[model samples]
Target: MDEKTLTISVEPLEDVKRRMLASLRGAADATARHTFASAELMSRTLTPARWNILEAMTGAGEIGIRELARRLGRDVKAVHTDMAALVTAGLVERTAAGKYLFPYDRVRVHFEFGAPAMAA
Candidate 1:
């Protein structure tokens, strides 16, 4: 629950692709399929750096550009670039308060799988 204090190691690019492929192939059933589909779609829309910004912004709610940079362990200018990219992609928005936030309308990716007997 304490997302701020949580630190996750970035997996290698090969590992990321492998995991994604595995997630795609090993989907348990329909619901799981859809969930993984959403993750994949989201992941594709993100650059590695942009994904970091999303994780940080998602965890912390609204934040300033400086703080986003600090959380990402990058300098201001580098994060400035990431922010611009995310903003352009519509994954994040800069508010009137001069802080960045994920939009209230969260994204959903829909895919139906399997048959009537089970959703998954």
Candidate 2:
């Protein structure tokens, strides 16, 4: 067998350290941020392909419809269909690379609405 062994220890915090820990431990954690209602950034207004395009753009940070289709395992026509919708919605931006720019912060409203969020 090819293997290695390692050990680790845990430390318990004291008063001031505990206070700092509390500050770091936010009341609104991942659960709150990712809630269906709160985390529902993509608009239902999008067509299915548009949704796909949006997801691809926001997750992959700008790529052409052909490449997007390649990643999506779909046809270029299909990907473009969605891209058209996404562009109309202003959720995805076309670039010189025939790619897209997500512009997530531009569309985010505290809860990240109207644009597809990072991969779930």
> Which candidate achieves the best TM-score against the true structure?
1
Q: Model 2 misses residue 111 by how many Å?
A: 11
Q: Which number leads on lDDT?
A: 1
**Cα RMSD (Å) per model?**
12.7, 15.2
Q: lDDT by residue for model 1 over 34-117, one digit each (tens)?
A: 122244554665668876676667545788989878777899998888788777755567889988886332233343345558
Q: Compared with the true structure, what per-residue lDDT tens digits does model 2 show for residues 1-120?
A: 322211111222353356457668873322211112222233444546665555555535557667778988899897777777666655556788766776442122233225657796
Estimated TM-score for each candidate: 0.49, 0.45
Alpha-carbon local distance difference test for all models: 0.61, 0.51
- TM-score attained by model 2: 0.45
